[model samples]
Target: METFNSSKDFLRGINKKVFIAVLSVAILMTTFSAMAIRKDVVLVCDGNEINITTFGGTVESLLNKQGIEIGEEDKVIPELHERVTDGDRIVIHRAFEIQLVDGNEETTIVTSRKTVEEALNSLYIELGQMDKVQPDLQSTLEPGDTIRITRILKETITENQEIPYQTTIKYNDDLDYGKTTRIQEGRSGVKEILLEVTYEDGLEVSREVIEEKIIQEATNEIVEKGTSRYLVTTRGDSRRYKDVIVMEASAYTAGYESTGKTPGDPYYGITRSGTKVRPGVVAVDPRVIPLGTKLYIESMDRTPSYGIASAEDTGGAIRGNKIDLFFESREDALRFGRRKVKVYILD
Candidate 1:
């Protein structure tokens, strides 16, 4: 009876140990099943879509599990503490550094906005109609992009300008050739001008003329010029002459010494005007005094006058205000070497 009792006790102890082992295994399987409950979630990050499976939890827990860091300016669609469910979509916009150059100030900004217009609106930066912005307002914002804003201003101003007068000349046949008479005085005018000026960042960029008004009309000056041809001789004699010239005078004879030809040569003792050389003949520059023009010669020094002469010849040495008087004898020609005289041109 004692042996049978010991055998029953040993079998009961083995059965108890087996039951404990099976219960522990059951508990472990249940815990693992609960931990494996995962949900299908879609994450959109910076415009890129991603499919992910995560254990059911809050949005903050999901992001922490994925090792994603959130910034102050970053945007998240769902609240961080919101519980996540199956097939839930989560959107995230990562902020990026951007350079801002507004007028003369430069600064760095971090923004999660999609475009330049949205970014400026969030910052409360206003723009004018005439203002200009670089990278355009509609352009997409990129990482490390530089945005420039140019402030423009316009203003209109008035200015006064002076107008110059004109001078006119009229010819009068009654007055002498060397005389002039003033008929009217000149007066300047006044004009008003309107200008539109443009400035960029407090600096002048350009200016344009908008309107012009003439305040006063200018008066033209008028003067009269003489056209008559007449003069009196220095000898107190009233002589009617077309022109007068002070000329350097010299005398020449119709000999081999002056004419370079003997008396019997083909052109000897003849003048350029188809006349014979005589005492009253004179050589002159044909450009100054036309050949065959009548002239009277008077000496400037206290010497006898050369009397009346005719411009009937031309000489190679006679240029400008120069004259050569013809003489009959070589002795008389040498005696009147050179002198200044006044020659009158008769009409």
Candidate 2:
């Protein structure tokens, strides 16, 4: 203890020791800072984060160490490879999925385009005349957004249809010239057409159908169709004589037919049953013009009586002395029609 002398001397030695200790501590700290690894870094992908150990200062270096490479358009937490600190938060992002659905077409996209038009045009899609767009064609694209394109086409087509003609027949001998007959009949036609159609939004937009020509024509048919072709005219004399119908007729009647017998059939008037009648025969009331009464009726058709007629008939369809006239053709019967005419009693 006596080696160092007084109190001042002892204090000086202690101060020097304290200074040396501090100096040594500072040097050790500096050396360790240069050699030790940096603290762990937190890297976030999406919303979740993971710890990464690195000795890098900037994000770019740390990512390189972590085997992560980023593109210009790739998403990042702090943006493209920023400078980082020990506890700094770093985020790495990859492109999200995008899908495009257009009518029946579906496209899965994996692009980093920022605009809708750029995305669509990138795929080389063309718009049509009536096609429609969903996003107005100018909208910006988001991380996971999609764009759609629609197309339309238009065209026309043609088909077929039918038409008809006219013909004539006459009993007046004044029928439309050459061949004349007491019957009228004829046939009809067929056609072809064209149609035009338009389409939009993958559906038929509109159609215009046009009728064009008759492919097969119909000829007029004549009931009792004119069969008679050539007729011999009266030679030279030029006499135009029309036939006359006679009201008088002869037939055997039962003696009891006291009021005189009525006109019968042209060929067969008597019935096999001994009943003095056939179907459709009409017997008048005696006070008006008794049974077996003969009446001359006129104005049935152009010719008074051309076909065979008979009174050897009676029917519920007949009334009074007004007998129903019968014709071979149903059409002729209907054409003769139902009409009121003058009737004269002649026994």
Candidate 3:
């Protein structure tokens, strides 16, 4: 009876040991199967779509399991420590450094917006119609990219301007050379100018004249000039003359033979025109050279020139193209023989 009891006890102990071993193995398999259970999730990164099955508890754990590394500059949609569920959607965007110059201010930013326009809109920046942008608004932004914006303001203004009159000179033959006569006065003209002024960032940049209107017309000044004849004397002096004549000139004295009277006669040395005989007085034919006409006598030969004289007398021998020059002394008259002389009528 004791042997039978001991064999039963040993077999019972082996059975319990085998049962315990099998039960421990079942528990380990159940725990491992629960830990290996996976959930389906959707991952979107940089516009690329991806579906994955991960055996992770949190978003960071799931991404790490998939070997997806996140940088400091990168952006993620959901919180990294948040627990993930079945059919969860996760999005990630890569960031880059970009410089934006808005008007007179400059700012540096790191963003994941695809284009410059989207970036500016995301920042709530508005653009005017006249404003300009550098690198284009629709251009893709990259690392170390830069953008510039210029504010343009235009305004139109009207102004009154004065147009100066042009001076014109005209020659007039009736007026003397070195003399002027005003026929008209100079007047300024009026004009209205429309201008367009452009400013950049509150500072003037450009100006343009858009339109011009003439209000008043300009008047020109006029003058008359003289074109009289002039004669240059022997002493290099110039004088105005009306006429000229070449005549035969002879010399006479206030004597009884020359004047047909003696000194005792009242009109002994008197001329036909009742003028006293003098060195500058001459007798001429009235038809050729009228009496009382002023004259300038220039010697045609080498003889001394009779500078200035007047035709105030007529003689018996003095006819057409003939003149008689008077002298006080008979000796001087006898010495002055007949000669041809040039006479000019003074103005």
Best by TM-score: 1
Tens digits of per-residue lDDT for model 2, 95-155: 5457787767777876555566766676677777567676767887766665666666667
TM, every model: 0.60, 0.34, 0.48
Put down candidate 1 lDDT per residue, 136-208, tens digits, no spaces: 9999999999989999999999999999999999998777876899999999999999999999988999999
Best by lDDT: 1
Off by over 4 Å in 3: 1-52, 55-74, 77-91, 203-205, 223-234, 237-347
Q: Give the TM-score of candidate 2.
A: 0.34
Error of 3 at 5 (Å): 25
What C-alpha root-mean-square deviation, in Å, does candidate 2 show against the real structure?
13.7
Each prediction's whole-model lDDT (CA): 0.90, 0.54, 0.85
Better-scoring candidate (TM-score), 1 or 3: 1
- Stronger candidate by TM-score (2 vs 3): 3
Candidate 1 residue pairs that clash: none
Descending-lDDT candidate ranking = 1, 3, 2
Q: What lDDT does candidate 1 reach at residue 211?
A: 99
